[model samples]
Each structure stands twice: as structure tokens, then as C-alpha cells.
Target: MKQELLSLILPSRNEAEGLRRLLPELVTLLPDAEIIVVNDGSDDNTLAACTEFPVRVISHPYPKGNGAAVKSGARAANGDVLIFMDADGQHKPEDIPALLEKFKEGYDMVVGARQSGSHAGAHRAVANDVFSRLATWMTGQPVEDLTSGFRVVKANKFRTFLYLLPNGFSYPTTITMSFFRAGFSVAYLPIHTPRRATGKSHIRPTRDGLRFLLIIFKIGTLYSPLKLFLPISLIFFFSGLSYYLFTFVTQHRFTNMSALLLTTSMLVFLIGLISEQITMLIYKDSD
Candidate 1:
């Protein structure tokens, strides 16, 4: 296989202690790879600790979310392949080679799927499972871990998604769906994720979870608006049709409510159709 340079992109927020251990392991494991750590508004000594390491540090004066950090790292990367991993120490640097090996198989992207039971808490595990199932349904592929930060992707292919990414924690969803929508090959490699060595998780279940839902909806609409919108529109249309049919069969006339329902249903479907066309045009132009 031809040798290719890899850029390891780590998105961190106040993870000084984790990086202390992670940086050394990464350096030993991926000696030839360039590591870029995006410090997402750390108040601690996160940046200070990284100064002694052989890694490039990109600091965000104020906290931008993980997605923003990943975007910055990607923009600054100088390698043919990009590997994104969390700086919280949950992801193992030793698994980097497995992801890189998958890239050698001509796949556009390779995701590291955390083994079941590796998550820190039960609630988080459930949330991860739900998101993974939703993603699988959207892509019509078995997505084991929709939220794993440990992933390897071809840099050029990933560049196409920079504009669509959110600045928060939902980047994995957008990137996974984008690859499937654009007809790029994506493969999953199962790996175990250990608990973070230090620092609390940045995610707030209530706030980030809702934001995550919105991100999923946005990506769903962009990739297959018709698939998402059409079903809901059809339900509305059918309910209206049923009411109208009932009125016609019983009294030979449509009531005001039935007429209004039918009108709204038609409008909903029409809007979906228009949105689908616009989405296709935008995707085409991007290509």
C-alpha cells in the first residue's frame, strides 16, 4: 500500500489532564502523523500542558462547540486523510491504525463504533442507541454508533460537508448522513471506548439533546427531504382525504372543516415537493 500522511484532529475543552496522557500515547503510536488539537475555549491549563508536546494547538479564545473545533482542525490539517478523535481520553490512540487501515481499502470514510457496554452511564448509553437507530433508519444502513468521535475520513471528501456542519456536538450525524447521501463508501470498525481520564463531559442532556435532534432533522431534510417530508405530508393528506370521503358518502357534500383540512394537506405536500427540489439543486451545485 502507498504511504499517506494522516492528520489527527482532537477537539478538546478544558481537558488538560486527559491530554497529558493522551498526547504522549498518540505521539508514540502515530509517530509520522501530525496531531492538531483545537482547544475550544479552555479556562484551565489545557493549552499550557500542550505546549511541550509535538502537536499543533489551535486555540479558540472563547468556547466554540466541538463541531466548530473539528472544523477548525480540519481546515488547518495538511494531510490526505483526517482522523477525528475526542481529547477527553475516551478514545484509544492505539485504535488509530485500524481506522487508517480501513482508509487504505479505498473507502471514503471509516468510523470507529464503540462496543456495546462501553459507555459511561446508562442514560448516555440509551441516548446513543436511540440516535444510532435513527441514523440507521435515515441512511438505510446499520449505524452502530452515530455519535462516536473516533473516525477516519478522506480529507477532500470531508471538505464538502464543512458548510453543512453545525458548531455544536452533532457533527457526526451530519457527516455520516452526508457521505451516504453523496454516495460515498463508509465503513464501521468496532472498538472499545474507555472512560475519560479527567474533566467533566461538556454535553448537557437537556440542551444538547434537543440541539442534536434539530441537527438530525436538518441533515435528514438536506439529504432526503422527500423521504422525511413526504411521509408526514402523506399522513396529513390521507387523514383529510378520509374525512372528505366520509362526508361525501354520508351527506354528498364536503363540510367546511373537511375542505380546510384538504387545502392544508395539499399545501403541505406542495411545500415538501418544492423543498425537495431546492435541496437537490443545492447539493448539485455543491458537487
Candidate 2:
């Protein structure tokens, strides 16, 4: 197979020590690939450490979320293939080649699925599982790891979902769902995630978890509203139908509960129809 140039994009914040170790390993693993590091307003010596290596560095005066940094790196990258990895040293550089191999099979995106035993804790593992299942249900295909940051994607195809991405940790969820919704082929390669070399995790589970859930719902509504809307509408419709039947059999009178359920069902279904039309329009424009 002909060799393809790959761009390794790393988003960092206060991870100077981690970069010192990660950069060297990446250079050894991917000698021909270009490294693009986006410093998301790190107060530490992260910027200084990057200058020691031959890397293209972009910096934000104020700290932005991981998603924004990734967007910046993608925009600046010149490679045909884009590989995103966290700067915390959790993702191994050796996994790059495995991810690239999927592209040869005509897959548009390949995610490096972290092994279950590699998780920092049980709670994190459970959350990841839940997110993955939700994504699988929404896309009608298995999503092994919705939160994995280690991924390889066709740069041009991945760029289409930029506008819809949130500047938060859940951006990966949005990207995965968007690709699946657009009928892009996605595959996963199991890989081990090591603990970060230094610096504490920036994620606040309570705050970020809620934001992540919101992103999932937003993507669901945008890509396949019927998946959610249909189930909800069905519940209301069935309840209303049942109530009316019971009233006729017993009191022989229609009740307010019956009317309420019927009205809610109609409203929900109508909203879903409108959302579907809007989604079609968005995709049509992309085409």
C-alpha cells in the first residue's frame, strides 16, 4: 500500500511533563507524520516545552475546552489523514499505525477503543458504557467507545461536523454521532490507555457529565428525531387510547386525561416531523 501522510493533533493544557515524554515517543512511532499541538491557555511551561520539539504549536490567550483546541489543530493541519490524541499521555503513540490501517479498508473513521481494564475507575467505565450504548441505539450500529479521544479520520469528511461541535469534553460524542448519521463507515480498534504522566484530570464529572448528556440529546434530535420522538409519542398515544377505552367501558364519559395524552402525542409527533425536515435540509446543503 502507498504511504499516506498523517497529522497527529494533540490538545494540551498544563501538561508540560506529559508532552516531554509523549513527543519523543510519537516521533519514534510516526517518524513521517506531522505533529500539531494546540496549547489551550496553559499557565504552566507547556508552551515552552513544545518549543523544544519540532512541532507546530497554536495557542489560545485564554483557556478553551479540549474541543475548541482540536478544531484549531484540524484547521491548521495539512495532512490528508487526521489523528487526534490527548496530550495527557494516556493514548499511546504506537496505536497510530493500527488506526491508519482501517483507512486502507475504505473506512472513513477509526477509533482507538480503550480497554475496559484501562479505565481510571469503575464509575468512569460505567459512564463510558452508558454513553456508548446510547450512541449505538441512536445510530443503529455498535459504538464501542463514544468518549475515546484517540481516533483517525479522513480530514475533509470530519470537517463537516465542526459547526455543530461544542467546546467541551463531549465533542467526541457529537463527532461520532454525526459520522454515523451521515452514513460514514466507522470501525474501532482496541487499545490500552495508560495513566497520565503528570497533572490532574481537568474533567469535573458532575458538570461535564450533564453537558455531555445534553450534547447526546442534541445530536439525537438533529440526526434522528424519530428515534426519541417516536417512543415518547407512542407512550402518550397508548395512554390516551387506553384511558378513552376504559372510560367508555365504565363511566361512558370521556376524561381530561384522555384529551391531555392525545394532544401531547400529536404535538410531539409534529415536532419530530419538523425536525426531520430541517435535518434533511442541512444534509442536502452539505451534499
Candidate 3:
């Protein structure tokens, strides 16, 4: 395969020590790739560490969010392929070539799927598995990892849906589904990395975890609104129909519950149809 210009975007926030160790190794392996370190209002020596290596550093005056940093890097990147990786040192720079290789095979996006043991804890592992399964069912494709940050994507394609990406930790989830729904090929390559070399993790399960659940629903509604709306509509429609039948057999009259359920079913279905049309229009140019 022919060589492709690659851009490595690292979104950092108070991850000085991690960047200190990671940058040198990355520079050695990816000498030609454009390296960009987005400082999301890091108070630490993150900026200083990045200066040691040949990298472009974009600093946010104040902390925006991880996804915001990604958006910034994506806009500034000048490469055919864009690689997004975590700044906490959990993503191995060596595994990047594998992802690129997958991309070379005509995949629009390639994720570095982490093994079960690679998760920070048991609960995290279980939660990630649930997210993966949910994504798999939603997209009708096997989703090996729903939250892995280590991935390679076609830069133009990745930039097309910038508006849909949230300025938070759930951007990965949003991007993964967007590709699938857009009829783009996605591949996952197994990867392993050691424990973080520096500061603590930024994710708070109770807080960010709740946001993740909402993101799942968002993904459903955004990509395939009917997939989510149709099921609920079916439930209400069936219940209403059954109730009306039972009333006719017993009291010989339709009750308010029957009318309410049927009406709600119709409304939901209509809303879903409208949403689906809007989604199609939004992505029509991409097709």
C-alpha cells in the first residue's frame, strides 16, 4: 500500500508526566507524522513537555473538554489520516501502525480495541462491555470497543460530523456510531498497553457514567431514530390494541387507556419518521 500522511492528536489536561514519557517514544516511531498536543487548560508542565519534542501545541485558555480539544486538533490537522489517542499514556504508540494498516485495507475508521484486562477496574470493564453490546445491537455490527480513544480515521470523513461530537468523554461513542450509520467500514484491532504512567484518571464513574448512558440513547436517536422509536411505538401500539380487544370482549367499550396508548404510539412513530428524514438530509452530502 502507498504511504499516507498521518496526524496524531493528543488531548491533554494536567497530564504532564505522561506526556513527558510518551512524546519521545512517539517522535521516534512516527517521525514523519504531524504530532499535535492540545493543552486543555493544563496547569501542569504539559506544555513544556510537548516543547521538548517536535510537536505543535494548541492551548485552550481555560479547560474546555476532551472532545473540544479533539475538535480543535481536527480542524488544525494537515494530514490524510487523523489518529486520536489518550494523553494518560494508556494508549501505545506502537499499536498505531496496526490501526493504519487496517485503514489501508479500505476501512474508514480503525479502532485499537483493548482487551478485557486492560480496563482500569472490574466495574469499568463490565460497563464498557455493556456499551459495546449496546452499540453492536444498535449498528448491527460487532463493536469490539465503544470507548477506546486509540483509533485512526480518514481526516475529512472524521471532520464532517464535528457538530455531532460532544465536548466531553463520550465523543468516542458518538464517532463510532456515526461511521456505522453512515455506511462506512470500521475495523477493530486488538491492542494492549501498560498502566498509566502518571496522574489519576479523569473519568468519574458516577458522573461520567450517567452521561454515557444518555450518549447511548443519543447515538440511537441520532443515527437510527426509528430503531429506538419503533420499539417503543410497537409496545404502546400492541398494548392499546390488546386492551381495546379485551374491553370489547368484557365491557363492550373502548376505555381511555386504549385510546391513550394508541394515540401515543402514532405520535411516537410520526416523530421517528420526521427524525429519520432530518438525519438523512443532514448526511445527504456525505453520501
Candidate 4:
């Protein structure tokens, strides 16, 4: 079989120094692959730094956000397979080949799952675990790293979700769930990221952390609304049943609270049933 064209996309903002060292390594390591860098309005010499390199550089007028930069890069990439990695000097260049090899194994997407202790902060680690668990339950597939930026995906498949992709840092979470819900095959490979070698991380855990949770719930609802609704419905239904039994034993009658809880449970289940049907209609042929 003929080899597919590969495109390596790096989204940067104030990563001039890191790009100075990383870009050359990419050029030397993967000479034939197309390398494109999208500068997200870095005030530093990010654009000038790429002038000396042989990479195609595209600069935004102002800061658009990391996810926006990724969409810009994906739109410009002309490869059968596209690989995205951070320009913050976290992802290792050597891991690129492994991701490509996994892609060749008939997987539509391959995510670089970071090992434990790979996070820069303790809270970030806890937050990532929560996202992963939520994603795993929502998709019915084990998601090792739902928020990892280092991933390989088929360009054609990835492009389909561009419109749905958020213009923020939660792009990874959105795409990962979308792929799984669309019935695309996804695999995870253990990868270890080093501490930043340049500027500090742009992510504000307390701020972006809330955004991540919202993105997770948004994608979960978009893909599988029933997965979330059904569990809550069951909780309310059982709680109401237990309460009703207790009231019957104590006062020989069912209380209004039990009736309200039971009614809410039925309403929630009805919503989940309707949502399940809508989800099927929406994603019928999306794959």
C-alpha cells in the first residue's frame, strides 16, 4: 500500500524559544512531512523565529485561543493524516513516529496518554482524571487521556467535527468524545511529557477547569444524552421509592415530597428516551 502524506501542526503563542529548538528537530526528523505552525498572535518573536525555518508559518492577527489555532492549522494541512502537538516544549518529538505507526494500524485516532505524575499541578491531575472517567462512562470506551493535545487523527475524519469544535482549550475533549460517538476507532499510547522548557502554561486550572467541565458535559450531551439522564432518573426514582416506603410505614401514607420526586423521575426518563432517539437521528450517518 502507498504511504499516506503526514502533516505535523504546531499551535504556538509566545513559544519562540521553544519553537527555535523544536521546529528544527521536526524538520530533520520528518523531512518529507509537511510542517505548519500557526502563531496565535504571540507578542514575542514567534513569527520571526519561524522565518529561518523551512516550515509554512501562518499567523493570526490577534490571540484567538489554542483551539482556534488548531482549527486554522487543520484547515491548512494537506495530508491524509494530521498530527497535532504543543509548541510549549512538553510533547517529545520522538513520540511522533509511534503515533503514526498506531494510525497505520487501522485506527482513526491515536491519543498520547500521559502517565501519572505527568501533570504540572496536583489539581490539574485530579481534574484530568475526572474528565477521563466521565468520558469513559459517556462513550462506553476507556479514554486514557481526554485532554491531551498530542494526538494523531485522519484529516478527513477530524475535519468533520471542526464546526462543532470549540474555540477554546477544550478542543481535545470535544474531538475525542465526538470520534467515539461517531463510531470511529481510537487508541491510546502511554506518553510522558516533560516540564515546560519555555514560557509558563497558558491554562488557568481554576478558570479553564470550569470550562473543561462544561465542555465535557456539553460533548456528553451532544453525543449521548441518555447516558447522563438515565442515571439521574434512576437515582431520583429509587430515592423517591424509598422515601415513599418510609412514609407509608411511619404515617401510613405517601408524602408530597415522594410524589414530586417520582414525577420528576418519570419526566427525566421521558426526556432521556426522547433524547436517545434524537441522538440517533443526528449521528445516523455521521461516521
| lDDT for 56 (candidate 1) | 98
Could you give candidate 4's per-residue lDDT for residues 1-287 as a string of tens digits?
Answer: 88889899999999999999899899998999999999998999998999989999989999999999999999999999999999988999999999888878999999999997674688778878888988888877899988899999999999988987888888998888888888999999999998888988888877776786686667667678888888899999999999999999999998999999999999998998898898777667676
Q: What tens digits encode model 2's per-residue C-alpha lDDT throughout 30-123?
A: 8888999999999999988998888889999988899999999988999889999998888988788778877679999999998867847666
Off by over 4 Å in 1: 120-123, 248-253, 285-287
Give TM-scores for every candidate, taking all chains together and pairing residue i with residue i.
0.92, 0.94, 0.93, 0.94
lDDT of each: 0.85, 0.86, 0.89, 0.89
Model 2 error, position 186 (Å)? 0.9
lDDT rank, highest first? 4, 3, 2, 1
* lDDT over C-alpha atoms for residue 86 of model 4: 97
Q: What's every prediction's RMSD, in angstroms?
A: 2.0, 1.8, 1.8, 1.7
- Residue 115 lDDT (model 3): 87
Residue 2 deviation, candidate 3, in Å? 7.0
Residue-pair clashes per candidate:
0, 0, 0, 0
| Superposition error at 229 for model 1 (Å) | 0.8
Q: Candidate 2: where is the Cα deviation over 4 Å? A: 1-3
lDDT tens per residue, model 1, 197-257? 7899988887776786576576567577777767777787788889989989999998887
Native RMSD of candidate 3 (Å) = 1.8
